[model samples]
Target: MTLAHRPGGHSAARRRALLGRATLTWPGLAYITAFMAVPVLLVLGFSFLTRGRFGGVVAPFTLDNFARAVEPVYLRIYAVSLLIAAATTALALLIGYPTAYAISRLPARWRTVALICIVLPFWTSFLIRTYAWILLLNSEGPVNRTLLEIGLIGAPLRLLYTPGAVIVGLLYAYLPLVVLPVYAALDRLDPLLREAAMNLGASRARTFWDITLPLTIPGALIGAIFVFVPSLGNFVVPELLGGGKTVMIGNLIRDQFLEARDWPFGAVLALMMIAVLLGAFAGQAAIARRINGTARA
Candidate 1:
């Protein structure tokens, strides 16, 4: 009789625990559904629906926009955007990892201050930062004048409104994003493990390559996503810095909506961006699972 009563009591406790978890998760679920899920579904629905003679979407359904999106020219634009985004991610990683590691190794009292300094620029307007780059890279700007005075080049070199300038702006804007996650990972790492590796005669480089890098990959991957996504979808950088010559997918989308008055085409571009983001999410999940499996081992 006691055993029978014990099983029922345990079942009741399990139900209560499950209910508590559900209650805690409901708010977040609702928030995501309201903001993220709804917006995505709306875009998807709009992509299939026909566009009015003007820029607006009509109620009727069609696949004409998506069909057009697969054309060779649009496909090339997508490819270029992917390539640029990948390059930006790589550059951010190259700079951010070392910076994060350095910060993580700093005195405990200084770590917070260092991180705040890194993040301080983000609190300001993103457009303002990009505009500042425009001013610096302009033909008669301080950078050009200094280079000319130093005889580094014969002329201003037309540095502004070019692909290289766009890339430079991207790196400057997104460097902090990559650093923060990497710093978090390094901060959470067990210093004793690194010391143990050193004591076992592993060189510093070997320890970092074998132990530190593998452990820190999840955070690095997150940083890559953070940099890649925005760079891929960035309009301001291309507009202000690219001088309308370097046409990216983001610019194409803007033209479709504003100039061409093609809302359906814009929706299709939006869907493509969503697909890329989903792919990034899947990659992150895979990396995280691999990290967890290695931890278990």
Candidate 2:
């Protein structure tokens, strides 16, 4: 008998397929709903609430917290955070692109080794790695000692506890993130394209610029976004390297909740960060679509 003419048999098969699909997807859906969606909703709801005199959130709703976020002091923090994040992303790109290119050109066996070296830092605790930087950049650290011995400086230059130090920390942390994506893009690239460009009388540099670089822009953008987003809200790097002098949005949010005892204000700041991140993600998506469209054309 045909499946349609088999009465309840068709219905039973359809139900089984539906059940199997639900079984595969439901766990992931539930996890996201419980963790990501719920927390985001809680933060959004809290942002409109009043802060209690002691610590917790209060009942009556208000916009005062958001208003306070726009005040000069907080705005200055936001500006500094943006500057730091931008600098970090730029530096990571500058350093990572060449490294990734070189790695991609290596023999297949060595390519794995190079990539492992790039990612090795991630195996350790991030906090521990930051502490390692403190040891390396401190006044009496090896960097300063080497410079002094070489007569490059009369004394230990103040490398640690500065905005520059914060940038260094960020670059150290996120450079690998930029390298991996760029390498993936470069490695996936067809070598025949470059050969064809050279056959057409294009110089090596010209081929790279016209043929390879344009194609890899999306990957570079992905890496830049990856580095920039985390660096914006990074409290640990600024706190450890910038030494409280460099207060970013992340630090400000922490202080609002813990020190100032203003949960609502903290929620507002957190929500603002989320808004900025969402805007970045949207921009990335649009740019990716344009790049893909260009590729298809």
Candidate 3:
């Protein structure tokens, strides 16, 4: 028999294929183990330990940090963080859905232009972008100057240091994330389905509600999760815009680690946040699997 018909040949081919996949994947696996897994394990270990005398942990390990984290004061911070994250996710979805749908409807050449506009903000530094918002929202900035010129308001208003400003910053920062995913979903949709609906006497709105919306729900959910998780843990926008007035879980964790010199408690907070992060990732995976399953069906 030819080599192709031999069992050893087939086994050898399988081995070569496995070896090639291993070669391709090992670098990524090694990076994750070194950076992500190892750091997470270190943080987990530190969470149960006692705080150090000066800055580092010298452990007669204890659960006090975890207990401290459940206190009412920190719970309020958690609540505020959740509220801000939810608001950001809602606003991103509200804006991103239509934006993505519009992009999907564009001519192929123009679609690229539209997407470039959507993500153009990313070309600049995030810190720089945040600072630019500060300048625009400041009392003497162009936003207020335009309002003054138009007689819209008597004053600049306290736009710089508030929860609303934080939300605005977050929405601006993460809006592209929502738009990209929703656009993918909309782009993948078969036009024939909408055509068939219209042919069957359904209106455009009805077709979108009945067909397009349901199909793209996975993408929307993925985008929402993407925006929500980061917004929840974000500290920078709240600090710069909220001006120390809006305190979230991220700020709390930062303070515990850097300011208060309580690494154990900080680790506890990080651990809690990591739990939420892991849950978000799991949900994202489930949505992806559902999308794949739907595509297969």
Candidate 4:
């Protein structure tokens, strides 16, 4: 007679609750296990194992791959990759923060369109986009032609196939990544906080520093991670845009896997990439926690 005992109603409700939780978590867990965690484990295993003839892993385990990765030649490439990634992150932040701020201040009617424009490039194939830069920056390309026509120089500037060009390509490809999170953060910020600061006799700059900036740091950090991690491991941009002259860790990994036919070494490089990405994510999480703690206090 009681609802709890009527026709398995309570059992059905419990089953539904369990099913709801399973439905919510099953897709994400499956994805992580299949694509992220398993692949990462495979790489880690290969890093510690010996490479067999022609790129397969051998039965023996060894640390030689990791040891070899730290040799001067490879270390130099890693250092350069880190430098370029850092530079790209910095440039993306500088360019994206202002754009995000302007976008955040736009009327609501225009904001969605602005965001679409920011993210629209992501819809295109990344390789195709990089190749487009190839056409634009080539010696006989439109950019060079315009510069020559304007009498800026006697010849086309060597705009492609340099480290600077690689950085430029990276910044172009990743700027939207930095902008989107920043816009999300800034849009969530309360404008009245700025007004409150002003009411307390704070200057616009001071209000920004003390209120707006802190509130948006999380978003900026998110954007920086988005730019930094991928830029660190990018091979296509440096290959196509840099014309195979600029070699980063991603290129190194590719060479090991394909050209050198050394799976163990490639696995080591892959592990290092994962480590760097994880470190970035951990750093971001720490900063976010600190920010939230400060807000709570």
**RMSD list, candidates in order:** 3.8, 2.1, 2.7, 2.1
Clashing pairs in 1: none
The residue ranges of model 2 lying beyond 4 angstroms of the native Cα positions read: 1-10
Question: How large an RMSD does model 2 have?
Answer: 2.1
What is the C-alpha lDDT profile of model 1 across 1-297, one tens digit per residue?
Answer: 444478587777778789998999998999999999998888888899887876687877888988999999888888888888888899999999999999998998899999999999977898899999988999999999999999998978798988888888888888999999999999888999899999999999999998899999999999998999888888778888989777788898888778988877898998988888889989998988988798769
Taking the tens digit of each residue's C-alpha lDDT, what string does model 4 give over 91-138?
999999999999988999899999999999977788888888889999
Report clash pairs, candidate 3.
Answer: none
Which residue runs does candidate 4 get wrong by more than 4 Å? Answer: 1-8, 19-28
| Residue 1 alpha-carbon offset, candidate 2, angstroms | 14
Write the candidate numbers in order of decreasing TM-score.
2, 4, 3, 1
Better of 3 and 4 by TM-score: 4
Measured by TM-score, how close is model 1 to the native structure? 0.88
Q: lDDT by residue for model 2 over 48-86, one digit each (tens)?
A: 999887788888888888888899988899899999999
Question: What lDDT does the true structure give each of the candidates?
Answer: 0.88, 0.89, 0.89, 0.90
